[model samples]
Target: MNAGAINETDICESGSQAPAATQFHDDAPAVAWLREAGLRPTRQRVSLAELLFDKGDRHVTAEILHSEVLEAGVGLSLATVYNTLNQFTRAGLLRRIGPTGSRSFFDTNTSVHPHFYLIGEDTLIDVPEPLVLEQMPNALPGHEIARLDIIIHICRKSRDA
Candidate 1:
């Protein structure tokens, strides 16, 4: 498979695209979803989409997605998972959150909002609603801020309380 290709199962005669079938299967909605998002729906892409969309909006890291794919009986490498994720993000189907430490979490919800990052646990959850900034900050001399991300760090409550 090419570095940009996700699945080797189904490929067109040109050796570059997935077959565009009109029929919709259990996974067909995922294919359609990808297409609507301007992305080719390959086997791997559809499978990953199903997992990512199965439980509604949720955040997942590439490692977590890789494990889920393996548990789902899908044969996919970690690298492929990473590539597919980046593709999906670029296509605007998902959102990518930083290397807080070493890895990033792919948020299924692409809308702009704040998130709660659990320290030590390395987990993230939506903040229920978008955060409200009291005052916006001014960019430096030649730079401009494109967006803002408010991540709140949380920890377990004291056992006594």
Candidate 2:
């Protein structure tokens, strides 16, 4: 198979089989972004990247993205979506956030900042203000703090007064 092509033999990180054939669309920005991130610009990857980054920085779960792919008439499995998201995260092209439970949200914005989780809507919103940490606790003898994630859960206030 040529570069940027997705064939049946291309196995996803989840160990699931990929689609038999997928048309590769020429997405210049997505291709350049993937190359700069040191990731191969596969057909599925380019399609998903376009959908993820075309609009703007936002958060999306694998399931949500799978639904979107299906809606866009692209044949991609949920496992593939999960695998691609993880790959993008490892490449520093995306950030993963799991505020609670087993659900994971991939954010296109990789900047260091806090987030507000809308409990009712099950959505995450970036906190505009800069997060200030007065002091950070020392790490263990051999380990150092790699990163910090802060998620503030919010819900609509009850109107029954």
Candidate 3:
């Protein structure tokens, strides 16, 4: 090997490779997730999935994801992000949190649990443990409660930490 030459491992580890073209294939775990979710793992989808899954469970909005994609230099549009997020939600890959003032958050943790929504900061924080409800409200006349979701709104303290 030449003294200043790079190898495949170096290229792969450098984070400079073309993400859409080289990072994931049909056999990749993210790709498998798409397949399980009944989605086609296109290059763009794979790239977005990589970002969403690389970190642990998280709550993100389309706008936030668009910023992230832009920072990563991924050539994607906000509309595309919204579309992908909606598709992921419908396919059960993600859970939609809320439409807080025309903005919705997509939660990677799809399990049933409570969340804390910080009002001032507009952030969503997951509750570490499951919350047990003392009593569930009775379903309306002819309807049944399919699920129960509780969101506690919080505000910043007056004094600084």
Candidate 3 residue lDDT tens string, 98-150: 83767688989876667999999999989777666655566699865444456
| Per-candidate TM-score against the hidden true structure | 0.76, 0.80, 0.78
Candidate 1 — number of clashing residue pairs?
Answer: 0
Which model is ahead, 1 or 2, in terms of lDDT?
2
Q: Which stretches of candidate 2 lie over 4 Å from their true place?
A: 1-27
RMSD of 2: 9.8
TM-score of 3: 0.78
Which model scores highest in TM-score? 2
Off by over 4 Å in 1: 1-27, 157-161
Higher TM-score: candidate 1 or 3? 3
Pick the lDDT winner: 2
Write out the backbone clash pairs for model 3: none
CA lDDT, candidate 2, residue 27? 53
Q: In candidate 3, what residue range of length 10 has the lowest lDDT sum?
A: 1-10
Q: Per-residue alpha-carbon lDDT of model 1 for 43-86, expressed as tens digits?
A: 78889999999899999999999999999999999998998888
C-alpha RMSD values across all candidates: 10.3, 9.8, 15.2
Model 2, 1-161: lDDT tens digits are: 02112121212222322332444447589988877877777898998999999989899999999999999999989998998988888777788889888888999987666899999999998998866666667669986555667899999999994
- Deviating ranges (above 4 Å) for candidate 3: 1-25
What would the TM-score be for candidate 2 when compared with the true structure? 0.80
